[model samples]
Target chain A: MGLLKKRKREGGEIPTASMADIAFLLLIFFLVTTTIDVDTGIGMVLPPKLEDDVEPPPIKERNVLKILVNETGQVLVEDQPSAIRLIRDEVKKHVLNEGVDPRYSEAPGKALVSIKTARQTPYDAYVGVLDEVWMAYFDMWDSEARRLGFPDYATYSAAVAEQGAENQIRDKIKAAISIAEPDKQ
Target chain B: MASSHFKKKTSVKQEIPTASLPDIIFMLLIFFMVTTVLRETTVQVRTTLPQAEALTKIDQKRLVSYIYIGPKKLDGNRLGETGVQIDDALVEDMGSVRTIMYRKLIEQPKLIVSLKVDQTSEMGIVLDVQQELREAGALRINYSSKREIPS
Candidate 1:
């Protein structure tokens, strides 16, 4: 009877002392191997393919801020040789001109920043110029947001998103950037 | 008297209650298991992305498709001519990109093409690829770049 009782007690419980160790081992393996880096980048929308016979809309020369990047990574703004660093300020001034400067745009809505690159232009150089243009617009939006009693544009945009409202700032001061095709190689 | 008191204290049965330890570990293990992505595509080219300030995070990974453009990685640390890779294969003919991307767009109409171009590549190939994308009607593209650290 005593032997039978010992067998019953032994079979009643399985050893769980090492379960924590086993779990910790698997957890450590996964923890060390897991990668959760988020992908980030500059987003853009390309123009749709145009029909051959269709005529493209024409914009006045004065309203366009033409930026050109050549094979050697040199930059030109409005037909003037310029550095990449100055492109941001030029973009801002052109966009916020309000018709005060005849050389710039007639109005914020009419302002179009056109980027043209050579076929041999380095990818990084193009990205650099594009980055500057985007930064200029971002700065403009920030000031606009501040004027409207918000901390910054991001917060204001977030609030607008929450209420499912249109982004007035973006609509008012649109980022009318155009990426012109490179000359045929 | 002090030695006897120390001996009596040491003789008392003392054990840490570890019943919940396994449960805690299992919870953590499950979390890691769920969040881990086991299968990732092996990249063929050496695409060191450019750095920029104005960056937007792509929240949904499902809506994005990657296109890598860089110098082809040859055997023994040698790099060949610039090549464009979509999925696993290097696109031999530039015209075929339109068909491949069009098929992808059919599958996911909201497809966002993430262009992971190497910093050293020229604009010629990039434009060619972009034209093909335009033909495919996949106009939404993202230039995959790292955030520039402010000086």
Candidate 2:
């Protein structure tokens, strides 16, 4: 039995524990560095939930202007197919034509513009429309401010000179031009 | 005479041990390869998205809507028997679809409506969809595209 045991002795044993540690370290390193992907889609501001059934304030008929985008990407303002370049002017005309009422003059939430676009439209087209709408909002606000004997530009320099801080005035203007349009895409 | 008879004795022996490392590594590699989840192509619409130098990463998981523009057909035949399809859908007439979207938005305020449009689709169609979203009060929107691989 002693002779057989001596014969069974061989070379040094392999280091499996060290190899396992190295492999585990490598796995953890890769896991830490790998990036997880996210999906891209539309962005929108959601309306706040109402606890009680409070009747929404009545909106003036002329204050609401509707802009439409078809599957072919043509912008129609009140059923007329208008060129993309002309949309700003058209929107301005609509806003100006609708005289400001006491409700809207004191509060900005009264004026609302509805914009509707088709699902088949491209992203560039949608962005263009949004840019025009935003421009229209600013233009209308500036026009109203100028008529009210305020400065034409609503920048910080002008606001600081006229009022203590422009932030309150800016908020007032933004509140006046509430975007009521909902995106369907 | 006794001293001449006593010569030194010698023993000869050899042994071999099995190397199990390579076998174990090979099996582990095969197991991981089989179990690893492969990245799948996400969007269903077939489109060649426009390239951008800088793109913001998006994280929100929401339902994405897709639109395809190809040759228009009447009764399974191209309009006017012509192979070319013209984009004719108008933006103002999308009230029905808008109502549906409004309902969706009311249900999940965080939902993002993605537009996957074909490269060949006219710019007019794309614009129409965007306008509709804006009208629906959707403020957050993002476009989908594949990251370009450097050659």
| Candidate 1 deviation (Cα RMSD) | 3.3
Q: Write the per-residue lDDT of candidate 2 for residues A27-84, one digit (tens) a residue.
A: 5544554444554322334343334678767866656656676666688766777866
The per-residue C-alpha lDDT of model 2 at residue A3 equals: 69
Tell me the spans in candidate 1 whose CA falls farther than 4 Å from its real position: A1-22, A25-29, B1-14
Native-to-model Cα distance after best TM-score fit, residue A32 in candidate 2, in Å = 12
Model 2 in CAPRI terms: which quality? incorrect
**What is the C-alpha lDDT profile of model 1 across A56-169, one tens digit per residue?**
898998899999999999999999999999999999999999999999998888899999999899999999999999999999999999999999999999999999999999
TM-score of 1: 0.88
Worst 10 residues of 2 chain A by lDDT: A101-110
Residue-wise lDDT of candidate 1 within B1-151, one digit each (tens)? 9999999999999999889999999999999998776656777888999999999998778788899999999999999999999988899999999999999999999999999999999999999999999999999999999999889
Give me the candidate number with maximum lDDT: 1
Poorly placed runs, candidate 2 (over 4 Å): A1-42, A46-57, A89-108, A117-127, A134-185, B1-41, B47-151
Error of 2 at B48 (Å): 4.8
**TM of chain B vs. native, candidate 1:** 0.82
